[model samples]
Target: MIVDDEQPAIELLEKYVSMLPNLEVVATSYSAIEASEILKKESVDLLFLDIQMPLLTGLDFLKNSKNLPKVILTTAYREYAIEGYDLDIVDYLLKPISFERFFKAVQRYYQNSDRKNIISESVPERNHIYVNVNKKNHKVNFDSILYIESLKDYIRIHTSTKSLVVRMNIGSILQELPGSQFVRVHRSYIVSKNKITAYTSTDIEIGTIEIPIGQTYKEIVEDLCRS
Candidate 1:
């Protein structure tokens, strides 16, 4: 669950949470009062909470609520670090949070909690993946995928019919794809193994399109040749 007054902050955290296969967002609230209401029905193992909210601050809510689950405080202010730690929060994240910092905070939670098995659990095989685009979930079949390109925080999924610019990172999207069908040929590219029409030491060709291969990924030359 993520609780923040700002919509962008909630969306940013949602994007981060999506990167972790084990983490699932159950709810998001714009205020502490709204979150309190949600807690009555939903059982959340972890809470990504913002310290400064409109009516009720995160610290005030924590003091008032009973049987509160583990918490990780998210705030831009530095003064509240001591107070937040006094509340026994799993971690404190200063905003604009980077993915590396966010990952470390999540690791802290796993180390402190007994639910470590959740991190190691394997995802079941699937032929398609549902990507959220324009506020809707679009079903993208693996067979239709030609290649994927990274655009910083976003990725473009090029398919047989069309392309979609999704708000996802390259590493996260790669985990969602099957290893046998897809390979990361470069830092910004993931190509379908079956779609490769031609290749060389420096690049791979899919149809008329040419995708560069990174120096570190040169081993893929031999791997693809064997495959």
Candidate 2:
């Protein structure tokens, strides 16, 4: 079941649902009131719910409802994250949702679900990410990335083999990459922790290249060195 206020979001989730063989869309509602009414009749396994609605907000509805299924909160706002997690939501997805991120969220749902009928292919470790470059989605292995450099509106990802210029901000791309493997040492740079050869308080060395560590990141850099 998918409950969202916007028609486009519902359509997009429907498209994503169609891609998975095991997943099925039982119901879709534009408002929380309509969804509550549908829930009385339908036996839903999982719910993709939006945070904001007209009559009753998603959070308010969740608070008042009984015998609710496992929920995955879909919202554009980041402020309600802590409250959503407190309600024991399966996952919280920020919108303009990518298929990759959507797949991960579904995997989380399956992991948390008590149901035994699980899709084997739904859960798999991902080592690569697909990014749009020159109107084409290019698969770049996480291990191949040496460092990432910000170029105002665009970011140049420096890989071991080659560099790809992508039209994304530094902060947005950091969220996509694995946090454990990468560290942002400067405002304009994010370096792979595994790729570092040497480091001082002011700079980090990756083979022949030396990347300066910014003032704000000095403490974190020092901590990394200590660890």
| Candidate 2 lDDT for residue 69 | 89
The window of 10 residues in a row where model 2 has the poorest summed lDDT is 116-125
Displacement of the residue 150 alpha carbon in candidate 2, Å: 26
Q: What is the C-alpha RMSD of each candidate to the true structure, in Å?
A: 13.7, 8.6
Clashing pairs in 2: none
lDDT of each: 0.83, 0.84
Per-residue lDDT of candidate 1, residues 1-227 (tens digit): 89999999999999989988899999999999999999999999999999999989999998888898899889987556546754667777878987766776776688567875465533445789999999999999999999999898789999999999998877567646765688777878889989999998889999999999977677855577576
Model 1 regions lying over 4 Å from their true place: 117-227
lDDT of 2 by residue, 1-227 (tens): 99999999999999999988899999999999999999999999889999988889999988999899899898997667546755767777789888878887787677556666466554445688888999999999999999999897788999999999998877567656665577778878889999999998789999988999988778768877787
What TM-score should be assigned to candidate 2?
0.56
